[model samples]
Target: MNTRDWNETLRSLNVGLPDDVERLKAAGYYEEAIARIDAYLAEDWTKTQNSPYSQGLCPHMDVQPENPTPHGVDVLRDAMIAQREIMRRIPAEYTWSKADAIAEMQRRVKDFTPEEFEMLDRENRMDWRFVEGEKRYQNRFASTLIATHADLARRQIDPPAQPDSEKERCRRLHEKMAEQGSASARITLKASVGMSDEAFAAALAKAKAEGRDAVHVRAWLPLPAACLSQSDIELEEFTEEPTVIAPENAPQRTVCWEADLTENRSFGVQYSYRNTAVYTDPFDTPSAPEQPDFDTEEQPSHIVFTPYIKALAAQLTAGITDPMEKAKRIYDYVTLNVRYHYQPSYFIHESLPEHCARDRRGDCGIMSVTFITLCRAAGIPARWQSGLYVTPDEVGCHDWAMFYVAPKGWLYADCSFGASMARRGDETLRQHYFGNLDPDRMVANSVFAAPFTPPMLGFRADPCDNQTGEVEADGVGLYGDETVSSKELVQYIEE
Candidate 1:
């Protein structure tokens, strides 16, 4: 085995070594550190199993491995087994306790009907578990299942009245925006796009408003990148005058506002931009690899080049010479291999690429980051861009990647969107996403980890993508304090 492999394997196995070796590591002398570790293992090989080190990673002598580690045999075995589980999705046993059930029985019996309890037990299992010495725990997704699904949300907890449908809430917010008469609401769209916008607003306003969650509506709704794809910019209206409007070109542009937030108030902005669909031919040779900006480098937390990423990139790009083609291979692999699903929020992910590789399932952001890490490992420069997927119908946050190719400049790839198309066997749409994107999108973030203009008050629900604007009141921000900002379409002109 090469010295690098030994060092990486040892590090992965969490083997302990001496201070000088640590100094070598501190100096980034991985090869030298591995060599020293190897020599130590060799000298102490026969005696380590009999010593106190036997309890830990006591390296046995006369055992040679391509991946060498001094960890005890049993320790290494257990570590490998746990690593195997952690490195991939496994059916882990959820331990619920009688104590936990007893504690919640009164509430469960009071809160659920017999049929409702059976329905909850079906596929959408409530996320409840007991930890040793701790109270039974449940998250919002778990606790709100009844309210979110069973229609008891309004009755269960006396929430302020909210628009029942997303469409209605959005329309109400737009009405409030238009009511405020902000400077932003000046530009209007063409007949088609305008009609879409108007219809959306009216429909949202007219929907069957149901279980309400719009508590004290404090929000900063994202605005389009004006002087770009969208045109005829206007600030339709507002609930209250915003503290600020982040610059037209702000990485995460927003109509920042704080309001007294009377019940049912929706604060929003209105703007229209032309959709300019961008495309590139992957068969075309790409520009040679160029040095990436510091922001696009190997961020240890999310995009670090671990051994698995390196190996995967190598396997995927083998025999590919062209950077563009190599990038395409990685993109294709990601879209094809990583089935898209709603990930458990962005904060829980440590190394997104590794998580993607292990779990084999994640949302668009997961697919984007995995593609970024692999392309970077394969020596292709790629970065992140994300925002809202604006349409007359649905508006939600989305993420995608951009890889630089000479002649073509930077091109887009939407693996999640593409994967959805692939599932339909829509070759045209699927391939289109590999090298193009619909103009019907808004970019709020040009780079991941891009800082907010005034900086957020505290932990953002989504620290990566900033399509849904943030909120703060009194002092620090409320993580999920109020309604998420939304959009409406008055018109959409194909031309």
Candidate 2:
């Protein structure tokens, strides 16, 4: 299948499971569910033929009538995908038994009891699901419980402290930029000084790909692009010569390579870039009479304006007219209300912002998308910006947002960081993130849910954002279990 066909198939997986298959799976009859799905796939149902599974498979599934009609095919495919997702979610995600969870909690909370655990479970403070007729909790349930529940946080003993150096770095950067008046003024005054030069090496582990018997393997690794805050990008080296390197300003930039399995099983790229910090106090700038309509409209798949989102936006921005103020309110709502939780792959989520808003739990990218969606719904222009959070001590995937407000131009919002600040009771730093960003970033994507330059023929590991990397073998996508990604910060220099 071509890229378009594969993309359609990926979207069709979101149609949901057929009723019978769903019921079977929910009752812990996994093997029976698989058998029913296989039986469905084996049937030949034409458009003229009436079958219990034919209706509501897909909106356009009735247009074509082959031996096995489009509706039958779509249903079969959706059922198979659902089965695979169910299996994938069990062993890795829901691993902790009740005793295991309580034992782990006791390590952190003094005299933790089964009764307390039951109460927390009743309040839905922990993430748990049924697996093989037994209740199992997620691996991070204890941490999430403490993070979200105030009483648990207070009862916890000796939580790890945030490094003072990190706090000082943020404070120094903010003070230096605020002294320069505005983001633009800060950029101009620093020009070449107070910039961070970072080098990162990303690789797909060879050991993970060693046993697969495939003729060809293809890979794409993120490369830093030229943006307002990032520049002087250099694609210094690669394990093998790249087949294509995306243009500097590509929304989702990547360095791509293809090789025979016999020749190479792993791929890697080493690159470096310079990032300058920019700070804008939205309160200090006066808004222009007219604002551009850019990024102020809904973008489907994730950044959509559903009724709940619209109502929430209306309530947040009620009795307020200034775009900047509306944007700040949206930011505050996300940072203060949403608790950070590690998520599964983005491919599994149908609507990120909606899920986050309703569940009140999400990771960095989810919170960023939620902020962007709410901002657009409130008539503020907001967009996505993500890649890596590179610091002197650590390097990892990260995401944040950017909003436009007339005369102030574009500003930044890192809701995840702001939420951390709120938890720490640092109001000043929490407010600082509303319009400013640190220089410890590497930006490779400027748009959300954008296709790669040379699109992958199979489904992407993460269709929404490219952060870690993507790899495919023989037109089949390899997920995190089949692939290993590593990021090492080679150099960090302050200029």
TM-score of each: 0.57, 0.81
Q: Which residue pairs in candidate 2 have backbone atoms (N, alpha carbon, C) closer than 3 angstroms, thus clashing?
A: none
lDDT of 1 by residue, 219-273 (tens): 5666666533345455555555677778877777766655442233445555665
The C-alpha stretches of model 2 lying farther than 4 A from their native spots are 1-17, 21-43, 47-91, 107-110, 146-165, 181-214, 263-265
Candidate 1 Cα lDDT to native: 0.55
> How well does candidate 1 score on lDDT at residue 186?
22
lDDT of each: 0.55, 0.76
Write down the RMSD of candidate 1 (Cα, Å): 16.4
RMSD of every candidate to native, in Å, equals 16.4, 7.4
